[model samples]
Target: MENLPKKVRSKKLNTRVDLTAMVSVSFLLIIFFMVVGELSKPKIMDLSLPHNDDGRISCGPMREGENRSITVILDKNNRLIYYMGLLDSPIIAPKEIQYGKEGIRKELLSRKQNILGYSSRNLKPENIIVIIKPSKKSNFKNLVDILDEMAIAKIETYAIVPEFTPEEYKLLALK
Candidate 1:
């Protein structure tokens, strides 16, 4: 018998995979994480706070007709501890520290009002200087909170003791 023409044998099988659903799920997960991520916090350290051009150790002398400055300190626990250099005693303690924006705002407002009443002085809150002293162990979140409070209080100049890098120290030493 004559050999019939042999048909070509097909040995390879083709498989297709659709990645559209996977890509959509990945996109959704990325969006979810982005929205849920923690907010950035400010940096806090124990370095000596900055001084004014004058040789004053702390807040400078208030300008004429100016209200006293508000000096707040943050302890290791990130609490709102404070000492008003002008006041005879401490106004706020570590335990009094609260995390809410409104809470801080209220504290600042009350302090401003109280200061105005003292010494028969009619001082505007804007004239007060808010000094922030955040400890090294304190979290950056706490620093940011205090800064926000100061801004809300409408204080123009604020002071922070920034930790100097090695290079900065060298430069300062030279000068």
Candidate 2:
């Protein structure tokens, strides 16, 4: 067989992608989401906490250490009554003559601690969310006060809403 001289490869076809348009589109999407996310508030609705294996009331997110949703019920005595689940026992109750803030702070801290477990690590209180549920007759001022206290504790994701059944509720109920 006769050997022919090797020829250099021809110019590549369709090998280059013009990223400029794609980059522009990405930037537009980022800008759009930023505008919308900033304008809207995180949906804060009341939810039943759920139960643990021991039949104890579980509040917040079931995963532990992660942000937990909650229900804040205001009883007739102008007292703060909290139940962990749709049917769980009250995990927090306000002390007479004492503000409800203490109870809330304690509960938040406790849940935070419980979630940390034996990992020998913990997250800041800011990452944990407190879903505040005020009764229909609850004073708006009281709700504000509770929110204020939560803020003081560095809880930034606190939500204020009426009752709601989040997907997590059913997931937790089965547990």
Candidate 3:
């Protein structure tokens, strides 16, 4: 019996795990997510801003003539105040208006038509320039809405001015 090989007993362990399929699935999921993340980037609209670091552009000198500029002041609670020409001598006085097809949009269309008609008579070939002044109380959405309105109106020249004039502040405060 001593010459015969002895039968040894060993503990049975449940460590036989096949991880090849799991590893392959995890890699596939990771690659899929990576590709999806790369493809799902947000589309950004192009905004034309002044090159000045202070975010304010120099007005220089105000020309004395029939003004073809519109100043739209954005305030809190979606309040919009608009004035044509200079604040001192406005072609159209500052008035509060809405944003939709009936409010500022209508005003913009009428003003554009009137200006174009008058300019055509004078043979000056002038176009309206829009100056958008967003106040501290205004939000980003308001700015974007105004920009969309500009695009819908087909405005070619517009400027975003974050700095509010004292008169503009008073105008916003009054309402």
Best candidate according to lDDT: 3
Give me the displacement of residue 148 in model 1, in angstroms: 1.3
The per-residue C-alpha lDDT of model 2 at residue 25 equals 98
1-175 per-residue lDDT for model 2 (tens digits) = 2687778899878878889999999999999999999889687898755566677886745454222444555433456654443333333322222245556667656665554342222544345556676656668777777777676666667677677455324333332
What's the distance in Å from true for residue 172, model 2? 21
User: Each candidate: what lDDT?
Assistant: 0.60, 0.56, 0.80
Candidate No. with top TM-score: 3
Task: Name the lDDT value of residue 3 in candidate 1.
Answer: 93
58-154: candidate 1 lDDT, tens digit per residue: 5545443223556565655556555444333333322245656556677777767776664233556565667776656578888888787777776
Instruction: Rank by lDDT, highest first.
Output: 3, 1, 2
List runs of model 3 lying over 4 Å from the truth.
1-66, 117-126
Report the C-alpha lDDT of model 3 over 1-175, residue by residue, as the tens digit: 7799888889899989999999999999999999999889887999743233456753545352346789999988998999988787788899999988999888888877777554422323236788999988889998999899888888787899888778877777788
TM-score per prediction, in order, is 0.45, 0.43, 0.59
TM-score of 2: 0.43
